[model samples]
Target: MMLFEKKSPYKQLLNLFLLSSFVLRIVLLFHPITTTSFSWAEIIKIFLTGFLTDFFVFITASSLIWLYLLFLSESKYTKPWGYIIFGGFLSLLIYVACFNTILNEYGGVLPEIGIGFVALKTTFFGLMLFLPKYRKHIRIALFSIAIFIITLIIIQNSISEFFFWNEFGVRYNFIAVDYLVYTNEVIKNIMESYPIIPLFIGVGIITAFFTYKIVKKSMPFLEKLPSFQEKIKSTVGYIALFALATFLVPVLAKQETSTNVFTNELQANGLYRFFLAFRNSELDYNKFYKTLPDNEAFTLLNQQLEIESNATSTQIIKGRTTEIKKNVVLITIESLSADFMKMYGNELNVTPFLDSLATKSTVFSNLYAVGNRTIRGLEAVTLCLPPSPGESIVKRKDNKNKFSTGSVFKEKGYSVKYLYGGDAYFDNMEDFFGGNGYDIVDKKTFKPEEITFDNVWGVCDEDMAKKAIQTMNAEAKTGKPFFNHWMTVSNHRPFTYPAGKIDIPNDAKSREGGVKYTDYALKQFFKMAQKQAWYNHTVFVIIADHCASSAGKTELPMDKYRIPAMIFEPGKEASINPILMSQIDIMPTLLGRLGFNYKSKFYGQDVYHPSYKPRAFIATYQDLGFIRNNILTILSPKQKVKQFDLSLQPSKLPVAFQLYYDEKPKNTIDPTLVNQTIGFYQTTATLLKNKRYQKK
Candidate 1:
């Protein structure tokens, strides 16, 4: 211990470096408060997670490095403890540098723990190299630990996800695969082969023994350690160099690429934005990208916005829609296109039950849906809000702020209930529905006999329908007119028919078999409804969630978003009124028909109302289109415009359509209308964030 020796300058430099790095990380955390909004709880969680993760990683790496060096050193010219102190300082600096760089990139650090994990791995390697002889042992031990920790974290987070899948199997199979499939394999393996704890411990012990053998053969420890002053000099120099490198690499890379940190943060937290940025990797993005909107699309979208904004807030007078509100039972069919039904001019006898029901119901021959997904359809029908361009309304926390039909009915003292076979939390649907005054009945609430959790995505449509009927009957006993929103999941892709059902030879890739099976399930639901006491008074409004596959258009061609919407009241005479309509029109149309006096806070008008204009708006990612009385305006991302006159000439589009086909700003509607339309869109967008119709 050379107490008289001069103190190393390296030690003072290392201390300064750590202090500076800590202050830098603190600055990075506070920077996002001005640009991005994060709750106080969220910010604290981020800081704590970052602090704990880095602290443990540095301690672990330093400890392993020090132990290896102690055993693997020969002369001990450098003290082993000095190397560990250096490693610790280096790891801590690396953590801060990486954390700050990523935090700046990802608007906020809270959601991007992946960066921290990656940095930790890099730090482990750097520590192993601090002393060449000890590198072999450190590598083996660290690799084992890294693999175990990552796997454990994945398994832990997947527990709730797996439980939901086991409870609701095979539902929406074609839609999106659930996390249960991954954990289910692990669970099965755990039961038959190995327990988690023993497996981890076994790996750890093997790694430790292998490391020990390698170290023993490679190098021998020195009998006497070096002077303390000399050790301090070596440690401080190593730390200073590591700290300098950490701060420079990221800055240089970012500068050379012309990419800043803010965009990175946007990608981290903004799901849709991230999805768009990495669209090529996602199956949904590839399918949806083929439909980005052109200038004409935006123009048409703006027109719909104008229609909604200018139309009186009292567009549908109160008491206008009560004529048919006699305990309404609504069914949202999955992937059911209007073109598939025999009544709608399809050659296939796919939906005989729906056709029969339509014969006695007030069939809306020209109804439309706003968006192309289930959530979009639900939002349009229940809330009467237009789907945001290329984004899910459910993902937006402020969705409850948007105007909704549920709020209207709830205001009228009607009990609103929503029933789905899947996890209502997937798209935050439960919170949205619950916030809008709907009693949500999801898979968790279903009875054992009422539902079979055989689907990975959700419960089967048949089981969901049966549950709906039961709930309706129970609610009927209360004497309160109820509005029930039922969504079908069996018709989604990867459709699995019930056992012993007729199996169509539709290719595994073909959705035809699932569609056929879903039709059969729909039939079963209606057949049961006929025997229920609420049948006569109940207004069964049926609408498809979205189109399955449009044969005529690859991108939206004005009719891509077309779906059937009908009102079926048992024992009532049959009537069909065809008008150009869409998902936005459902709210105003339904409210008007039911004789509700409420003014719709929607972008749609009643097709039946004499003064109401007949228009339809459809969107596909960035693409949008407008349809009126007999004219259709098509817009594409390429700025191509195509117009068709449905009245005088159905087959041929006008040459002038091609003139405005590019639909440049000048070729579209007048400037005054454009500004007015754009203004309305901005206003409505603001309303969505304001929580307008939701009860505080």
Candidate 2:
């Protein structure tokens, strides 16, 4: 019996595609990480919107298959120009395969399943296209393979999405898009984080079962090809649907429609979002977001700058002439949060060394990271600008020769270098840092014997620490002050380290293990540093690139961005400074403490400056956040602005409450704060886009 009355025998397969997609979404909806506070009506709306998104995603994806099968008809298959159809398929395959590896040499990845794999696929495809008698058998084989793979992919994606939501509290976004560029690190990280073999075995079994059932029902129907007229009619009908979807999807699938971010996320398909993110990853502030007139924006910004500056005391120790020659060591750790240490309220004592070091260092008790990514942290500290919408400046193209914090060191006759445990080419770090007057010392510079233990991310923090000392020691011998910036990696996922260094065993593969090991490495690093000739002259700045997790119910969770920053000078008395600061402010504050002054393009201001007013700039790729005077103002895409009042959580235990916040929606936006918020983000976006963010 015919399974369908339709001209296309693959109708049942399409139904499976839609049904399976819907089922996956229903599972995600009830996921523990997904919010359960939605109203019944809202839930219905989510399903309704999701169905539309799924259909459009399906249509856009299936258009090529429609074209291929339509051309495979006997009438078209034997035509003189039939090779064009085969060439088109080959070209499409190659583009998709190679797309993720465009930046292979520059710290971008050439994926493990790269060009060579795609070529093999092309050869198989050519055989199916040229041989008519074997075509049906080949088609059956191809359908089975494709069906099996697609089943595995959607299932795997569902599993991946669950983990992603558990970690970051949202569907795929620019971070997922960024992962494509660094496929090796991400793939290895996943391997270390999960039991991949068992999961794949389970998934493959499920895939094989579905493939058998689907092909048994669907491919036999394809043996009796549709009449030429029937094929044309069906093909035309699908093409029209594809065109309609292409038109409607961008209109219907606006990402941030609802006030609740997760609600908006649940209403979209993950694969569609991933493709959309790749296409529109960087949203233009002026185009997609609210903005003031350029002159008015800058005027408000300059007014805020001057007004804040004039409100403070200008007196300071003013002898930068010779004291500027002091050496500086800046250590930016991965995912180090304030709550991970005893110095904060962490009962776990995961960072005993950092806690002890805090007793001897000036701790910025209220420092927050600008964004939730490593590249953003690097951009914040180096460029000292408000977070640019879309991608960080460090990863953006044409991001070279900027007036960064390193430029300040270079102008002050200091040797500046950016040292990392991993490849510097990743995230365009080498290009950005090297273009901005810093020497790059990364994984490639290390000798095999120098690396005692390593993982997919890079060398362990201890190994990198030793390298930092060696590099700085060599610079110290040259008789010049050096600014050495070391970015660590042990505090990252699959957080394995050399065993027995800390009380935590290496095999546990936990964040606590990572944090404790990082603390131990710091103790060892400082022990080695103190014995060096450059020790007495050096000032160490320890800060986080960003927190480990930034997930919360709120759109922009304030507490998650809270991280630690400390300035440790040898033999200096430790003091706790409760001034609110962002990652960008640390460099300006450090330079001010050292009494070095130069042409400034940095948006960050030293809290000690009489004109320094306290404010913190925080953001995601699309949400521009500004926190000051107990108000959090966010500038989002679609010119939407939101304001929330931030206050310390009321609790009996003061220590725990200090690091967190309670956000209450404001009924109205403050005009002054809103203008300043717009001014800061707009000016940064405009300046960077126009190549005007320079020390003039």
Candidate 3:
């Protein structure tokens, strides 16, 4: 096709940009795994709204080339300095297109190599700027290189988006942002999950084809350049349109055409959604969500507190006794949801060890994770707080010296520790957990001989388990009660572990394999623990950080947040507690059973307390959900509050329930329930903002 006139090379490039986006976005929309059946009207609306969203992103993205071309006269374009500087950037892209992918696939990537390359390329390119004789030849060479690099990036992003959608069922969100922060793990994960090299080289022939077409179309540009005045006249619309798109962001966001969330998500542009997610990554609760006056909120929350140390005066208290206190070992497993267990309807037997262990443990049947991410889980179980909107408290600035579950243990004379199998610095865990007064044990603490199996996420679960046993044994020798909080990391993407350890083959490289292998490791740990002197004295608590997948037809599928929670001790009661509780409640409930009594500032309540209320907190980056009386109330940004019917039954082992929007919010919203929800979150935001939750 004749994309543009011979005189307008910029127009040809611009046309290709929009056309490719349309093709790629539509391909994602029609992807077999992600898409659900929709009406023809919904399809057209998705296309129309998505096009508008893409146009906004294009205006902003094209500003890169737009600004480059605006002042780029023949004199500037012909300069040796310009070609060499631009070529330096193209070199970086080439490094990423080839070398970066390979390094991630094998094992790990070295940032120091990239830094040294940058320094070397700068010196080499600087010398070229002095040699004016090579300007024309270098400029032509760079043009071809630029075309090739751009096409490679386009193809790479398409493959990544399709795979990301297949996993998460939406465009780029906060989770993708987190992946960007930890590129080494994310890259290795993508490489392990997919055949990146074969796919890239095989599918990359299209890159060469497009580069040739784009090069041929731009050949006329070398002969003669447009005059500055003509360029200004031709590109005036670009500036106007860019400003208009920027202004329309908030206005266009309110235009929701479909009731089905999946359709609305499909209608959105990936880059635009990413920009929105980034912009609101750390939202201030009082500013974004519905709230009440601090005094009134605190009073309402205090009224709802249960009797005997469950009050919220100055701090929160779950129980009032330290008589049953013993050495504690809390294991927070990664992405291990209730559905993965055989008792919760998983016939695959991925969690056979946990299933068998549950028979003699205090298994909570309806425990809901407060949020989707591991950081959120850590925040809830540690601080025992409702997720404080936006970033978890574990990652936020000024999260130190707080009233955490660890603080309670320390106050009760137990030596406390925070343990992880991965680098604690990944999610700011090192700072958060360390600042709050706990002996830290992460991948950095592992010695050369200590490592038996390792991957992008650091040591495997078995090694970490062995390390935990060692740490506990050391504490036992000290003759002080120990409270160890250990986080596992084997059940994640690109899930590889020590070979021949489980019934599932290691070559599967699947989530099932990951779960089963982690289960095997847990079993091994217990068998060895039985031989230890402190085995009977220590109370073993097992739970998941969060569910594996949080994607569903509705925003927060009630089932996706349900995880297995069990407390197994040698002579402890093994009854199944059928109460609806949140991840935040796990620690407090355990403490209650242990008879822990300390001044506290946590939102978690002891389910065993006589006056304890049955509620669960669930949330995403944007929406804050409070569930009570089978109704779900979500408080969102712009002071938006909505309610839906959850119809959750405590008797059900795992609640596979969806949010029914068809039900009237008025019917679901009890005035007292709404007020309680608002008061709980509003008071939390107030307390955290003022740093009032600090340890005395």
Candidates by TM-score, descending order: 2, 3, 1
Q: Across residues 1-696, which tens digit of lDDT does each residue of candidate 2 receive?
A: 122344343555566567776777777777777754787867787888888877788778765556655654555455665587668768866775656445344443344446556676677667766887797888778767766776666567777777777678778888999898898888999898778899889878876877777767665456776677776677677777889999878777874376666678778777777887788777888898888888788777776564223212112223334455689999999999878977667899899999889889999988889999999999989988889888888887768888788988888899999999999988889999988888999999999999999998889999999998899889999988999999999988888999889888899999999999998998999999989988998899999999888876677888889999999998889988888788899998899888885667778877787767789988998888999999999988778899999988865544422876878889988999999998888877787777777543
Per-residue lDDT of model 1, residues 334-447, tens digit only: 888766776656656667667777777777766666656677787778756545544456645565644577777777778989888887886568987887678998898877
The reply for model 1, stretches above 4 Å from the true place, is: 1-86, 89-325, 505-509, 549-555, 629-680, 689-696
Better of 1 and 2 by TM-score: 2
Candidate 3 segments whose C-alpha is farther than 4 A from its true place = 1-9, 30-35, 77-137, 306-322, 648-670
Clashes in model 3: which pairs?
321-595
Q: Pick the candidate with the highest TM-score.
A: 2
Sequence-dependent TM-score of model 1: 0.58
Q: Of the pair 1 and 3, which is ahead by lDDT?
A: 3
* TM-score of each model, paired residue for residue: 0.58, 0.89, 0.88
Arrange candidates, best lDDT first: 2, 3, 1
What are the lDDT scores of the predictions, listed in order? 0.53, 0.80, 0.78
Listed per candidate, the RMSD to the true structure in angstroms reads 15.2, 4.8, 5.8
Q: Report the C-alpha lDDT of model 3 over 1-696, residue by residue, as the tens digit.
A: 121355454565665566766787677767764536788988887777766766676667667666645554545435675686668666775675466555455554455566466655555454446565775565556667766776666666666777788877777888888788888778887777777888877657877887788777777774465676667665777777778988875455566535566787777767777778888778888788878877778778887664223224354453556567689999999999888987777879898899999998998888899998999989988988888777788878889999888888998889999999989999899999999999999998899899999888879999998999999999999999999999999998888898889988876889999999999999999988999999998899899999998776666677778899999999877888878899988998888878766666667888887767889898888878888887888787888777777553444443432212232344545767777889888878877888878887
